[model samples]
Each structure stands twice: as C-alpha cells, then as structure tokens.
Target: MKFSCVAAVALASAACGSGDGAHADPDLGVESSDTGALLAHADPEASGSCQLPDGPRTVHQMKGPLEDLQGDCVPTWTQEELNAGFTRIRDERMITLPENPGFERRIPWLAADNGCEERAQAASYYLTNWDYTTPYYARVLVKPNKRLILKTDNEPGGSVRWTHHVAPVVRVDGRLMILDPAVEPEKPLPIEEWLPRFSVAGEVDVALCRDHAIGDGCFAAAPVAPSPPQIGDKAAGLHLRLTAEWGVQEILGRDPHRVLGDCPPWVECEAEPTPDENRPPTIRHFRTDRLESEVFFPIYVIGDNFVEGVTTVRVTGNGVDEIALIDSSTMRSILLASWYDPGEYQVTAANGAHVSQPVVMKISEF
Candidate 1:
C-alpha cells in the first residue's frame, strides 16, 4: 500500500550520457532509439504537486550481486569524497521563484512536509551525478501495525509518522552512510547515527535497494511482498518498490513535492545555487550487446540528465576505448573495435566539466 503520514509526534528532528554509432537492432538486443521513452522531462505544469503512486508496492531485487552494497562491486570512498558529495547534493534543494517558490529547478530538500521517497531518489540521482558510485536506498520498514515516527520542526505539528522512511545510502571506506539532507543537513550519517531519529527504530527492519534494481531479479532469494496495512503487527517484511520503473524517470516523472502544504511561514528565500549548477552526467546502468564476454560487441550506457552535444563516453582499466554520442536524451552507444584487448574495464560518461561514477563492463571472451 502507499506510505501513510500522520501529523503527530513531538520534537524529533530531522530531515547523463553519450553514445556510439550502433543502430536499433532488436536481434542485437541494443536500442539506442529507446532512450527517449526513458527520458522524464521536468513538468512545468504540475510543478509543486507531490503525488506518489497509489496502492500496494513491490520491492524488487537489484541488478548486481548483493555484495555490491558491501563494496564488492561498488567502489568505496574516503571521508573527503563523502563531504564533497554531501555539499553537492544538499545544495540542490528547491527554493525561491517569487511567484512559486517551489518552481526552482532542484530537489525540494528544505521542505520535509512529505515525499521522503522522492527526496531520497533525487538525492541519489545527484550523488551518482557527482562522480560517486550509485547509492542504494536504506529503507526502514515496520510491520503493518506500528508507525515509524520522527520529531521534526519542518512538519506542522513538529513531527511526522510513516509506515516507512528512506534515504540515499552510500559505501564509504566499508561503511554504509545515509545521505538524508532534510533530516541531517550538516553531514552524512552512518547507518548507526541514522536509525535513532525515528521513534520505532527497534521495531523496524532495514533493507537496501540499489538504484539500478528497477525491476525483479536482485532479491529473488528473499523478496518482500506488499501486504495490506494492519495495526500492531510485528512482521519483518516491508512493502517497498523503486517507485519509477526506469532510471531518471524516478525523479522527473514522480513530480516530487516542490512546496509542502504545511510549510512554516518562511519567506521565499532567494535561490542560493552553487557556482556549478551544471551537474556532470551519470552512468546509471550499462550492458554489452552480447552475453558472451569473449566476443566483441557494442556496449550501451543508460542514464539521465545528460548534456547533449558535449557528453562523451569512455572505458578504462585493462584497455582504453572512447565512444561517441549515440542519443543525447538518456543513452550512449559504444562501438568497441575487435582489436582492443578484452578485460574488465570501468565505463564512465562525462559532460566536459564533470565525469560520472563508473559502471563495470567486461569485454573478454571468457
């Protein structure tokens, strides 16, 4: 079922790519033309609307092995990298358009009235865009009977409750840290520090869903089916879903709340955007044309917010191969020549000024 919110509780606090010259060949299983269907342009008409999908939800497994969340497939970062990411994503909060304060072109981080899922997703989007690895969602889910409550000044009653709460999580030096700017704007919090904000911390179960696991497969071994809401139950299951079926669309199509209905009477603050508003492109997911790693095939890089005409793709590690922009909307095509040696390499996208976190791609006939 859709998450529920209550106006109770006391003082708790808180909170692109390029392409190659590969064509749309279904037999090859690579479609450069399909990126348009995936692109979710900003909705100017429904700017401030914060409507989430209705009904029961399903939490699917991620694309990579579970070890990725533990830093096996994902890269770990230093504390300095963590600070840089915190600054970049937190600064993207939507603010100040005299006519419609929420009309600003950024995530509405400052307003915590509702839309935790959207805030988490948008924060993850910006994190991956800032040269960091794809961050997963660290969700706290409780049995149907109990509600997860938090004390915060942002809400009208100085508190808010939900069936579940989520935030972007990243791997830093072997630890998973929560990046919830709305709750803890000053810095990133380790999972240990994050759990205390909610009243029912001991009652909820936590789950991690990678940003790429849009559909089923990653958690097939132990899946959480959506259940009807009940009260006072103590089941270790969570009803969760990625919200959006594809990448980028999660942020754009969802139309996260730009302005909270119960926002405190604060003036329309001026948009204090950072000097570099143009974010670097991201590499959300990528795959080779063929299943066999030994064979030479074109690689497809799918992502969002790519800067057209300027974005470029490249692979490095065992070998170096550059790719041309195939479709600027949200995908890139890389034509790997047969002569290049085959081995595991990191694939990344760049928009001249910024480079995205790398996704692993192997081109060997193993």
Candidate 2:
C-alpha cells in the first residue's frame, strides 16, 4: 500500500537527520551500487516474465528453463522509500512476538529436526509465482496444518530461510523448476527433489496478503508486552526498548541493508518529537554538543534538575554511542545510573564530548 508522502519524508528526515554539520564517514559500509548483492544472482536465461494480470508485474515460474525467464525488472521505490517503509513496519509489528514461557522463537522451517530440502522447495515454488519489489520485507505466516504460504516474491525454485532471504524460482513448463541463489550458489536443484530434503515444522494460512505491504502482512497479530516504566539507567532503559524492537525486525530478516539498497546500517531508536510538538521544553542550562571519535560523531544531552515523573525523552538520528550519568554538585561522572532513583546526572559521548541535553527522569511516588 502507498504511504503518505509527508509521513514518508518525516520518517526519512528522522532517520538520516539533516546531515548539516554532520560528519560524513568516507569508509562507511555504504556501497557504490544501489542494488543489493542478493539480487545479482538472478539467472539470465530463466524463462518467465513479470507480467501478471495486474499492471506491469514480474513473475518467476518455478520449474522453467532459465533462458525463457530472462527479463529486466526494476524496483518501484528508492532506498529512502524502503527505509521509511521498514521503520513503519517495525513500529507496527514490534510487539507481536510471543513473550511468555515455552514460546517458539525460530521460524518453522529453520528448526533443526525438519528436512531443510523440502522446506526449501516449497519456499521456491511460492516465490516463483509471486512478484517481489525492493523496499519490501517478507513476513512468513505458518499455519498449523503444515501448509506454507508467503506473500512476497513468487518465483519458481525460490527458497526462504530463517535469515529472511528469498531467491528466484524458474519453472520450465510443468515438469522442472529451479531456484536461484541456493545455499551452495553453484548448483540449482529441481523442486520435487529438493522439497523432501527440507523439513516442514509448521504451516501458515494467509489471512491477509495485501500487495506492496512492507512485510508479509499475512500472519495474525501476536500479543505485545506493556512498556516498562524503567528498564535500567537512562542509557540502558532506552537501549533495552530499542533493542527489543530491533530484535523483532532481525527475526524477520528485515535489516535496512537488505530491504533498502545503499542505506547505512543503523540501530533503531525512538523518535521523541511529533509533527505538532517539534521540540522539547527548553531549560536554562540545556545545551547541544557534538561528540566525535575515530568512528562516529553523536548527539547528546546534558542538564540539571531534569528528572521528572514518567517523562518521555525523544531521541533521533543514529543509535547511542555511550551514556554516562554524573553528579551535578561533585562534577564527577557516576558509575551507576538508575532509572528508579531521582538524581542529577550528566550524559556524555563515548568519544568524550558533553551532550547538548541532559535527559531528566522523574517517577511519581504514589
């Protein structure tokens, strides 16, 4: 589905920041080519076209001759578009994973006991038949009866691993189909022969398969845990909550690098300001400072009398480099920072620069 252009721009702005006065790293992981390495494996001779009944669609028919399936397919959205889309998907689905005891963590096919080959074949068939565009993440919905169906990238011989990679599938007529980018990378196998080698631990029935959704958009929503008051100290608490959301995205293999080609590797953090409320309340001693190290330059906050009851501090840009709480009177950094206690603390950059805003946490005593 299409997202609001304004919202997309806001999200992108939050992720990349203004880059004004921001130090750019020359040797960062950003690649010259915009296309992902994974997509480079598409077979030149595969005998299928992306022309589905809908508009200009790309379809990979599993069990087809490679030569017959060769065609050029371009992604509709740019890297920025995909990044914003991924962030939205993560925020929406962050709370779906099961948190209680005895919960299954791994994807159904990725389990140890299941046959890897059979699962691979089924994944291949599903991918060959579907259309996949970049800037999209796949959400695998496994049902109870062993039926495995997906909503993204229908190409013949394509396989889905727990890593969240889906390959191309080419079907030659009805007899033989091949999946590209196999684990071996050298050999493409027939679907029927490959299916038995993979195991089917769980099944998924598609409750919803909306087109162009960021992730699978198939599985039913899972329960979410309530946000905790304080997880740890200022830094730890923020990191914990962000990490939980990142972990869920990782489980689905929705890394920014994979979904959005050429995007920087970023650790997700909470965005504090809203469209209506753009800036935090100003205090007298509040200051904005930049911390620089051999690796990165990060923004931080510093202030006195900042702690208040259940105050929500919003942070944007890249992930935190390091955080330290300090005593205001002593002017010395405190080793222990606790969210439960009210105290004056200083937040400094790992590279030895004072943060602009010193976040204050105040909990009500009722």
Candidate 3:
C-alpha cells in the first residue's frame, strides 16, 4: 500500500530555530525531538535513507475526527480571497525555480518533530528570499494532523490533540498551492487537497505578500531577512504539542477566533470533490457503490468483445505519452484501483479486422 510513487527517500531530520534563541531550550515541545518520533514515516536514524515504514500503508499515524463529525469552527477564506489568489498566480507573480515543475514534497531542513516550527521557519525563509518577486503569499492556517488518506490510530474519542497549524501557501502555476516546506516539504500540492488538512472549525488566512515596487505593506509574521534553518538547529526542539485549544494558530500570533468560535456567513464554502467516476464499460451508464467485485473498488473497462479488437495502445494525456499496449485481454481490463492519480487519460486501442469505436478509458480522481 505505498500510496503514490514510493520512489525518493524522505528526509527524517530538520533544522528549526529562531535567531532569537526560541529553540535553545530542550523542553520546547514533543514534536521537536527526533527520537520522539512524531511522524513514523520519518527515518529515526539520521544517516539512514528517509523511507516510509512498511507497516499498514497510511500517510500519517495521527488522525482526528472527520469533517462531518467535527464540532469546531474552522476559519477559511472568503470567495474574494480565493479570487485574488487565483488571479495572482495566473499573472505569474509568484516565485518559481526551474527545478520545480511542481509535485514535490521534500523539506531539506525539517525533521519529523518540527511540525509547527517548520511552518514558522519555512514561512520566514520564503518571505525573506522571495520578497521582491512574490505578488501574493500568506501565513495560512492548517488543520493539524491532517493525512492525505484515511488510516489512523484506531482509537475512538481518545485524547486526540486537534491542533491548528501555520504554513505558507503561495500561488503557483495559475493556482494557489500549499508550500508546506516542512512535513511534505516543497510539495506544491493543489489547494483543494491541502486545505482539507487545516482546521475544520474555520481558518482565516493572513495575507503575507507585499508588492515592494508599489510599496504595499505586508503583515509582519517573521524577520524580513532571516536565514533558512539547517539540519542541527531545525530538528532539535520543534516537536508538536497537544492542546485543547487552537494550537499553532495561536502560536503564530493569529486571531484564534478566525480558527474557532462563531462562523461568519460566507458563500465561498466549496463542495467536496467528486469521486472518480466508475462507468461500466459495457454501457454508457456508470453507478457508485456498485457491487462489481470482491476486491471492494475494481477499475473496470467494460465493452463488448474486448478481445477481438487490439491495436496501437498507449495511455495518452498523462504528461508523458506512455506507450503501454494491451496485447491480449483476459477479461475486459486490468484492475486500476491501485494506480495513483490515474485519471484523465485515453486508452488508444486498435481494431484488428472490424472497424470499431476506440475504447476510451477515463480514470477520475475519486
């Protein structure tokens, strides 16, 4: 169950300290120490290649109440903010490096223990380095202990520390993406998937970008030219701490009410993402919760006489034109549930003797 491509080794250590001697103390927090092991996926041995553990394949060990059952008021953006963010990125005003073609998750200076500290540190670094070119950036509030997929501690109503987090979100590739240079460092994940990891009660994103040319002012979150954290200082004492109240949001000096308490009426609340469509290949109609197979979710390519027609096959529109031709068909298609982000593609099948319609296979992001 190595979700996504289990390729590169994850860095298990980070450097976290403020120039003001905030991390000089050994008792800073639980998530600051390497041996404390906040994220089990982070390698305990600093010298070891940072690979995920081979147990039950889940993203993170920590879990909180799902959004529906939650009883907290999370602060989120108004429609105006979303619109501005979209506009800023589309204008190509955010920072970028040729190395970053997007889809990355490596924070070079963060360890497993430096959750909130990494947020603080990375925000400080980006604010300093990209000050000139940054059209818009924000000290975004995030839901603590948010996992990309659901696999958990398996305890009900236990002492789950539902903490709030502070991270940087920058407009990238004409969309706002989370630049969480700590936990999932450098991974410019889509805002839609990243936002769900923030406080469910609510989130008030603090604007951090300033157009220096126009002399626009920006909120002062960290030093104007702070140095980035390195290995030793970054992973020392930045462990996560449990709290009954808003944690990182308060630590980052944001208004706690923006994350918890009364909900301000707004129309920007987005609907949940639609799951991948499970269209029965045999017919035009597709249905959800269908009892297709015993394997739970089976990716089907239903069609009449799929074995007869076989030709120049390859998966198209997948960034790369992967020429994987399906020579012989045992059944209709191979199970595709295990493939990550296997959506938005066409299977170019060739007709042998008879002319038939090309079987187009679309895998949605369920």
Candidate 4:
C-alpha cells in the first residue's frame, strides 16, 4: 500500500543511512519525476515480513536499495579473484533494502548498446568510483516456458523471441521492488504480478548480476548470487554503459540530450565501416584441355594470391558451374562439372574480396 516514487536523481555519494525515524512517504509532490511516473502504476501483490530464513537481509546489510540491474548476461570477470563478480539470486527477492541517502537518485535507463565491453566497464568504474555508495544487489530469475531468442534473417537473436524477462529485486519494508534500470525506469512490483509482463513465448535464460565494484571482496571464483560468471550486468555496468553512451551528459549538464545514440529517438550518428573490396586475382594460365564429363573434372588454375581459404573458382563465359575448392595453397585447382552449355567458358577465381582474371576453358559434348 505504501508505493512511492523516486523524485530527484540519486546522488553519487557515500552511503548515508536512514535512522529509525527516517520512515517517510513517497514524495507525492513530484509532478514529473521519471521514476515517480512509473511508480504510480505499481501494484504490489504480496506484503508482510520476509518468511525465508537466509535472505532479504536488512537495509544495514545491503547499504541501500538495489540499482544497476540488467536483463541480459555479459561476462565481467573470469573464474578468478582478480576479476570479481557480483553475487546473484534467481527468482527471489530481498526483504530488507535500506533507504540510503543515494536511494532517491534517479538514473536514466537507455536502450540497447551493441555488446561493447570497454564502454560497459567504464560505466561500472564510474559508479563504483563515484561518491554514490549503495549496496547494489543481483537477482537473476529465469522465466521458464517463455519465448527465448529466435533466429531471424540468418542471424540468431534473443530479443525477437523474448516473451518473458528477468530482473533484480530489492526488499522494501516487507514487499519486494523490481529494479529494471536498463530498459524501464526503476519500478517496484511483486514477483507474481511482475512475472506476467514477460509473457512466456518460450524458455529464457536470465541472470541478475550485482557489482561489488572494485576491491569489494567479490571475485570471479565466488560471486554473491548463486549464478554464472556475470560480466557486464545492469546493476553497475548497464547503469554506466547508459551513462557513458548518453547519461553522462545528464550527470554534468541539465539537458540530457542524445544527438545520436544506440537507443531509439537518436539515430545512429556514424555509419558502419564498409568492407574494402579484394583485389582481382591475376589468372596466369588456364588449362582448356578438358571436355564435358558426366561427373566432375579438375581445372588447374595457376595464379598469384589465390586466397588459401574462402577462395572460390568461378567459371562464367558460355556456361557456369558452382565453384568448389579442392586444394588452394600453392596450386589452386577447382572441380568443374560438364553441366554447362557447350562453348568457350571463362574461368575466374575470387576470394570474396578480389576477382581473378579470366582463363579460357573450351568444353565439348564428349
């Protein structure tokens, strides 16, 4: 019943706890708070103190409410201590999230960033290094019998088939609040009701990773959550990725504008690099001594720089045959069949980049 929204942005400062008398209602005066707007629709299902024994630790334990949560999985550290990972919990919610001073801070959640690792790390570094100190949590829950990534246009994608989604949850009072700081603004909801938005298209593999930051005692070998080695998570990495890509402007400037960014609204500012064309191969000589055969025959092609791999020999003059590479290191020979129209065929080779000069191949009905 006590649903509140974050009005102001969370301060990137040290952890400041709320005392026993710190209990206060949501800042209803927030007219256009991004988080406040989303929290308005919050429908809490379950309430009361946590029943489970091991978790939902006190706010004092978690430092502050959960932040920096992601829906996808990206490896941050290998299985070692040097590269530490956050502890994660699946399909569960923490009961006691502290209302630290930084709780009210609102972080802008941006759209997709193409699996870039460096930008991801810089964000995490900023969050951890900054003054804002909140004990971020990782809650990884896999939605079973839900739609996962499906294949599209010869490329495998998970978002297309993603009917259900997973995220991290922080316990406030006695209820759990979902912190999906990647796509949507931070909105707190119960697990039962929260599970519906992601309609089960199929089964999905989801993980909630928390960032211990750096030198916080968490390592790759042993993470907080009982999950895989989380790389770039929403908890810290995502928050930062969004910031570096776009949010940083907001952190320093008043108007958080995206001239061109990864998410929607801002179109891609830069164009993708076009691949350079390969140099055409120089055909020194072509053995035009073979007649049409029923099966297949070899055409010896002597040339320079006939790509050892992925180089195909194409024949196109009177007729054409599907070029298949037999052995293309020193001597580039191709297997030619007799299915083409009987005439003078020009044989050429290509390595996906450059095309080789034409060689004469005379074929007759033998």
The best candidate by lDDT is 1
CA deviation > 4 Å runs, candidate 2: 1-137, 144-210, 214-360, 364-366
Least lDDT summed over 10 consecutive residues: which range in candidate 2? 3-12
Candidates' lDDT values, in order? 0.44, 0.24, 0.29, 0.31
Q: Per-residue lDDT of 330-354 in model 4, one digit per residue for the tens? A: 3233333335555777777777867
TM-score of every candidate? 0.40, 0.21, 0.26, 0.25
Error of 4 at 17 (Å): 38
Q: List candidate 1 stretches off by more than 4 Å.
A: 1-75, 93-105, 212-366
Looking at candidate 4, the ten consecutive residues that score lowest on lDDT are: 13-22
Q: What is the lDDT of residue 266 in candidate 3?
A: 18
lDDT of 3 by residue, 59-79 (tens): 122122233211111112334
lDDT of 3 at 261: 24
Give lDDT tens digits, candidate 2, residues 48-130: 55322232121111112222322222123334433333233222211122232232111112121112222222232222222
Better of 1 and 2 by lDDT: 1
In TM-score terms, candidate 3 sits at 0.26
- Model 2: per-residue Cα lDDT at residue 351: 18
Per residue, candidate 1 scores C-alpha lDDT tens digits across 1-366 of 111111111111211001111222111111223343223221112224422223223342221222333323223456887888887776543423333444333444444444465455455545544446545567665554777666764432366566556776666766778888667767899877777777344566665653212211122211122112111121110101111111122212111232222221233544423222267766655444212223344444555545545667776777466664353232222232323466777777777768888887666663
Model 3 root-mean-square deviation: 20.5
